[model samples]
Target: MTVRTRRLAALLAALSAFAAGCGGESDTDLVRDTVRSYGEASAKKDYQRICDDLVAKELLRSVEAVGLPCELAFKRGLQEVKNPRVEVGEVTVNKSKALVQVRSSAEGQPDSQDTLELTLEGGEWRISSLAKAQPQPPQPAAP
Candidate 1:
């Protein structure tokens, strides 16, 4: 075989090895994407779309827990707001569970941060919990 041909074969083998090593996206990435999609739907006031992304039990529980008031709030807030943006920050995953931090802003208001916990079930990611990002207390009103 020619020297050039052997070098080409070696390059192809290295490329294949790298590709195999990288494999596919991690579970954390999947959960992040799912949460982002849900947020986008919520921002659009597309309750049906948001509901479609949630697990059955979560959907039922959310409806019962918040009742119709939640739906009304979404409709009112989302409909009035234009160009909402949701940013998902660094996500950490352990085993089949993961935590994703998100920041959302609408119009020109301050960004709201929250964390979402997720689990991998049935080959899909589902939100298990959500906690609001608490702001640090303001410095004691200038002595």
Candidate 2:
């Protein structure tokens, strides 16, 4: 592994350890909290928190795979976003995995629907992946 990868792994491990003893939150709430927190962090441009506390290690690894650290990569992707808003809808949990429905909107942009996959890690819910829903086909105009 590269030095940056090692450092990121160490950072994640440390953060995980810090959260190892936290408990009492239901799976649904935990999953939703993670999503809401990620939205807040993204709006505030707090990429480090989003990388370390909100997202799964695998997602961070994907950023590193492209030769950039998680924070830089995630920030780059959101640079064009403004005044973001996140609304959590449905949350379904099965053991350590969960799926959360979200509606996201930003200034001058159309709202987007997405589902985020989360996993329980070190007693905390962490987002593993996010998939934007495909746009619905428009109906034909009536005669």
Candidate 3:
């Protein structure tokens, strides 16, 4: 083979290796994705997925505070919210923790924003806490 052809083959191999390495999502991105999944599962009342996968085991206590199983509590929470659609926003990650901002809207209601706290547990990102975001003042009109 000509020298040019050999060089091209080497470049192609390198590019393939780089693409393979990029297949895994970063920790921040994983947290954002997990939050999205949690929202979808909650809206669908798929409590099993929420309790077993999306939420950290430590959060089970809060879910069971009402004397119900975690899955049952999740179901009740979803019913109260009603058809929630979550939009994930900026995400920040620390060593084993991540925070994701999300806006959720239910039918006939204004959007509610929350900050989700996630922890890297058992090789996966799982939500540990959720808190309402502080409302910001309206911005002035642009000149």
- Regions of model 2 farther than 4 Å from truth: 1-23, 135-143
lDDT for position 1 in model 2: 100
lDDT agreement of model 2 with the native: 0.87
The collision pairs in model 3 are none
CA lDDT of each candidate? 0.71, 0.87, 0.86
Model 1 gets an lDDT of: 0.71
* Window of ten residues with lowest summed lDDT in model 1: 51-60
Per-residue alpha-carbon lDDT of candidate 3 for residues 16-94, written as tens digits (9 for 90 to 100): 9999988978887788889999988988889999999998877877778869999888777677777888999999999
Clashes of each: 0, 0, 0
- Clash pairs, model 2 backbone: none
The TM-score measured for candidate 1 stands at 0.63
Candidate topping lDDT:
2
- What order do candidates take by lDDT, descending? 2, 3, 1
Please give the RMSD to the true structure for each candidate, in Å: 6.0, 14.1, 5.0
